[model samples]
Target: MSERASVPKEAEETESEPEQEPVTTGAQSVIRALENAGTDYVFGVQGGAIMPVYDALYDSDINHVTMAHEQGASHAADAYGVVTGDPGVCFATSGPGATNLVTGIADANMDSDPVIALTGQVPTEFVGNDAFQETDTVGITQPITKESYFAADSDTVGDDVSEAFALADAGRQGPTLVDLPKDVTQGETEVEPGRPETPETYEVPEEADDEDVQEAVEALAEADRPVILSGGGVIKANASSALREFAKEYEIPVITTMPGIGSFPEDHELSLEWAGMHGTGYANMAISNTDCMLAIGTRFDDRLTGGVDSFAPDAEVIHVDIDPAEISKNVYADYPLIGDARNVLRQLFDAMPRAPDADEWRDQCQTWKDEYPMDYDTPDDEPLKPQYVVEQFSEMTPDDTIVCTGVGQHQMWASQFWEYTEPRTWVSSHGLGTMGYGVPAAIGAKLAAPDQEVVCFDGDGSFLMTVQGLSVAVREQLDITYVVLNNEAVGMVRQWQDGFYEGRRMASEYPWIPQFDKLAEAFGARGFTLESYDNVEETIQEARDYDGPSVIDAHIDPGENVFPMVPSGGDNGLFALNEDQLDMI
Candidate 1:
């Protein structure tokens, strides 16, 4: 053969037979886009339809954390976003897998946490044919997600991820869904040269209007007893520094919501140090007595407001939130500012004169502080109290420690009891009240804030839901403290049965929970039991001093119910088990 012909054939053979740099697949394109967006980790369960994304993750640089359930993965992603101020990613497939994620997506929507959800769909041709493992995921999640879309080809996968991230991190951040058809997973594509095409613009957080700022400042200046009610929005809007300055400059007192734990440092003189279902007596009393209240980033949940009529009735309300819909939704605000709390404070500080009653208002708030301080009498009885364990745990950890808790009595107790002195110090899924959230979320929180001490305040009932994750911490060798408030029952259910359901004693009773200390030991974690009230503090100190993950099980009274709970339809001071009703019970 001629030399030229041989050269051409040899080159063709080399191209066709020999290996070269791997060509990009649809899944690779998607993963590359995720990496570009700065995704630190992805939470998901392995599934057939979505395996391509999982496979891509192996080659790319993104970290994947396996979860027992898709719902847990979604919740963990949302919680991670809340703590880090960045969007978190979760993956699942179509049909049951996608359907299972509805609750979590809705929970993120309700609380406005930024989460990006990726799901697989049936092949393009079979989309409407109702093929196996096929469900209309886009339609199903449209109502729940901030934005929803499905891509049929590999070329569009990158665009979908970029869009999902943008929607999640945009103003009033919420969950977003981008579903991919399985056929697209195998297709090849060359990404068009440059960066991912972000949406035309992201929703810049709502800024404070001049008029509202003036009005809010005027109210603060005119009031003799001004109070600042800090909520989750303060932290969400990144307004903690502004809030701190305003509180100090005006000498106004501060109260925080359960989710707003650390926005105002607990050590600050004006800080409420109140939390969750059971807040401090002084916090509640001050709410009713203050002449003016500046409510920021709070939803005014039933637990926070008690009865609508009695909540801050005596005070002139100044509500500020980024979401206009949240304005006047619950408590009627006398002066509602439909803008960002942080921005409004910024504008108010510049335009209005700073009030001069710092000493007087500070003195009155201190009086309430002395009256109903967060003091739990150390009972002489031998059995350990969870309250003592929580207090001691807070003392041992630094002020910036991150506390994540499971749902039920222990969650509310921790919210009411622990002193969170820094923004994002406490994390949980508040709206859905998912049981297994604490342990996995603590893992995610540690990932987000590696410098801070992470603790999980879990109840016996809730801890059992995701006890498998105890192994997760050990395998990763993460430094976290798990404090199990063991009351030996589904305490919240029992409370309702005992109080509202006429003590019928339904399925809420769990006579046997496997030995928790042994369970921890098996997971390669240090475990101990607090047998007496005398040992509670010392035991917690030991748990803190341990080198790795540890668990402290306190034998709290099975009968100790969360108090000051608002009955199904009752208002403030009209609860089934309140401070006033404690003596009678």
Candidate 2:
């Protein structure tokens, strides 16, 4: 039996008490329930409506991290869950505070990160009166959250919180919210002081249907060129080893999505790197030419499948995912296996026959890799190339380092240049592509893995979006490296404007930029400025050697653009490569 199935069923249900105990406030019950749920940290800022809960938290063991913005807190909590595989917790006050968390909550929802958010509401009497700092949080968050709750009574505080955690960690995990009114938090009720009962485990199928497994196996066995397309689910399921073993047993090439960057070792023989908008030329070629495809844990988003009509037009697709709704939502799957990725892969491995000899196919792929290798040139001059800087940083950083990136040009460059060899080492804002995700996410990653080095590769525009998060790093004394690619413009937007909008640059360029080094000093953190490509290595080394949080502002070429990009709504073959990339190909 799989580990998930081995857990007792009773442990999955809400705990029930035999008798009511002494009177306790709703705020106290919330803190007690969170402790029972195994939450070690709570990220948020104190406010008027939520003061009682903060008072209760003062006596609890959970470490509270006060962020500069509620958005930062939400992102931090979401990233904590991504790294630890636990439901991250966050708190916010009423009105603006709760509204500020919307972006991060949506981010977690889109990425399927497990998060529990708690917000304060106006007193019950004034709920519909539009009182001071009152907003309909439940209505605002209903669309984005897995579940939303409004605490009507003090007695249900523990039950509501316990249920929220249960839902946040349940199937197709995402964010959950609880809105507690001021009266509810202050009200006293007869409740048990013990922890609420929650399910100890969730059961997933040990194996897929026998018929489906056999069909998939037959398809793979008969195909001349087969490929495995992995997504974030593999990392979430802790199935990298299983994925690698299955690929080797079948002599299949593995291509990952952006969120799935570290799902397979990029340096491995079977690894074809990422396949999507900014993916490797060879990986996209494999996608275009494969005869059979086995997709795991991916929804086949439009970005990955450039044109749904032409994506792998001739290939037979076999999709295995935990959610059945995703089976034929995009590309039709000839064989659909619905179960946990790890368990399904294990069963597939057991049912597979001897590995096939695809020497010709392997050679073809190698030829593609050699002919159109991902490359860039760095001139020995003043303004540095962001790609070259990232490449050098990737070489200097330890293998176990965790890299987090904000959305935009820098994110694409980091995804292209960094070779991720381990699972859960690369975290980023996908789906929503939110700017300002890098700094807070790095702080959360460092909190989850104190011994591992964490770096945030951020573009100037993205960095400034959540630059306030630097205060959290200084306050927590977290050792993180913030490398700002200072291009003085919204590079990705400008690239689009240049390509599609006839180079009408409107509000994309920054005429006056703050000196990041001085800003770091203002935050009581170390900082460095690098203008020349020659100083890249030594400056990074110095920042890494710093005891506390450090920010490195590297001025890069403002005109440099990411190449080998697939034009939006175009097929994989229609690549927008520059002159240098064309020469390499």
Candidate 3:
């Protein structure tokens, strides 16, 4: 914001001009490296120390989207990476700016998202002096990142960014950090203007041991109630095709973990309806009864697996993941597989010996699906209904479009409504349910995959937290659809209040009705008002058809809650809403 952000440091300005034909500072060199890496956008909150870097970005092709909070910037980048399978980049200042990126970085690390964080550090000479805007960012972020580098020497800025991208986009991709000291950022250097070498290829064991594959095949063949648990790895490893093939050949029910939500079709008969907390009862029951389980690209996080100790007690797990660390990280594996999930499955599919006919296993899962189909009535409920509108939104979009969400009640509703037919179609801060994530994340997703329609299902309260990003979308002219389920309250918290706090509406109201349509228009974006459910569909269809940013403000009952509630701290067995709760309904 300050002109200082556009000025190179006095130290750099005073540096001896390079003897070469043309000379560029380390800032320009780093920018070029990013450009070479195909980084088209950078999410950030600029600051004093990073001014030189910002200066280079002026009219340099790549655009920067400043977020309200640094965390939003990081998360937006994280979501972008997940959506596009490209390394996403975020910039921040030192100290608080760096600290703000912690939660989002941790989320990406936990989920193995490919994110690159570029942070400005105090001058190298000021290191450990507790200099203004100085913090031990690299040390602070080490535990949560796949790899991190701090370049105290300005001469190495380009290389640092280069290596950061390599680590972020390499095998089993995750977060990578580059802390560039202010002094170093200003330093001039002879940078090799070149392409990065491809990361060394690692062999993904295609053929599971014939005996082991046969054993797994026999176990699956023998079980009448077999199930497959897919995870993010399935999508990351591009195993969706193989998973579909295996599921089809075996004819067993295949459900996914939260991150793996869309790896298997929600509409698939073999789907156990997303097994874990907040999932379907029949799916849980199918998990309970299945004697054979195939877990791919999943860590079986607690949310997905009720309790690791008791999870699939009767089943033999055929665990396959690209990362060896994930094989027994959560649920124990009977036949541990360490390789690319897609590659492993491809081999399994080809060498797959005949398994028992799936007539009955598929039949049981189908029966469960038919019996416990997820449902909610029209937009006619108190506290504005969640599912009705979410389902409506889902019905409005094409199957290939993406639906990213913040981690909250609306996220859960989206899980129930929008059925993901492909991987990376639905992204959220699952392990770390951070608010204020939707808008910026939508920006990143739109940048990463401009052709695909990316929508953010934002809760009213959540949207307010990061509403500043609505401007970013408009400024960027991002083709993103924002369908805010306006409960006029922290819907998730209000739900907890209704169920746990005796329906006492304390501080859970957004008294100021945010004219989101006007706000979007204020930023020169298309906006719509669907005050009544009768016009919700038309409004959404119009928004979808629009070529630019759009916001559909659908105001509904405030007391309506996301049902099938698993009371906080309760186990999956205690879910509150189901056919059993229908009597109360």
Top model by lDDT, which number?
2
Measured by TM-score, the strongest candidate is 2
Clashing pairs in 2: 11-199, 11-200, 12-199
In candidate 3, which residue ranges exceed 4 Å CA deviation?
A: 1-24, 58-63, 66-68, 193-214, 379-384, 501-513, 567-574, 578-585
Mind giving the per-residue lDDT tens digits that candidate 1 earns over 140-221? 9999888898877788777787778877876677899988888887678876312334477644556666776788788878
The pairs that clash in candidate 1 are none
Question: For model 3, how does the per-residue alpha-carbon lDDT over 1-585 read when each residue is reduced to its tens digit?
Answer: 110111232443465643423326777777876865767778999998777788877847887888778888998899888877777889998999999999889989988898999888888889999899899999999999977888866566787788778678766879989888877778887774343333355333454566766666667667766788888878776678779889887677788877888788777766765767678767776776778888888887877776665677788888887777777787788888777787778767766667656677677777867776677765344434667677777777777777888767788888877777877777787776777778778887777677777888888888878887877777777889898877778877877676667779789777787788887788777878766666667778899889888987767677666656544434454456643462342
Instruction: Name the weakest run of 10 consecutive residues (lDDT summed) in model 2.
Output: 1-10
Arrange candidates, best TM-score first. 2, 1, 3
Candidate 1: stretches off by over 4 Å? 1-23, 192-198, 356-361, 545-547, 566-570, 573-585
TM-score of each: 0.90, 0.93, 0.88
Indicate the worst ten consecutive residues by lDDT in candidate 3.
1-10
Clashes of 2: 3
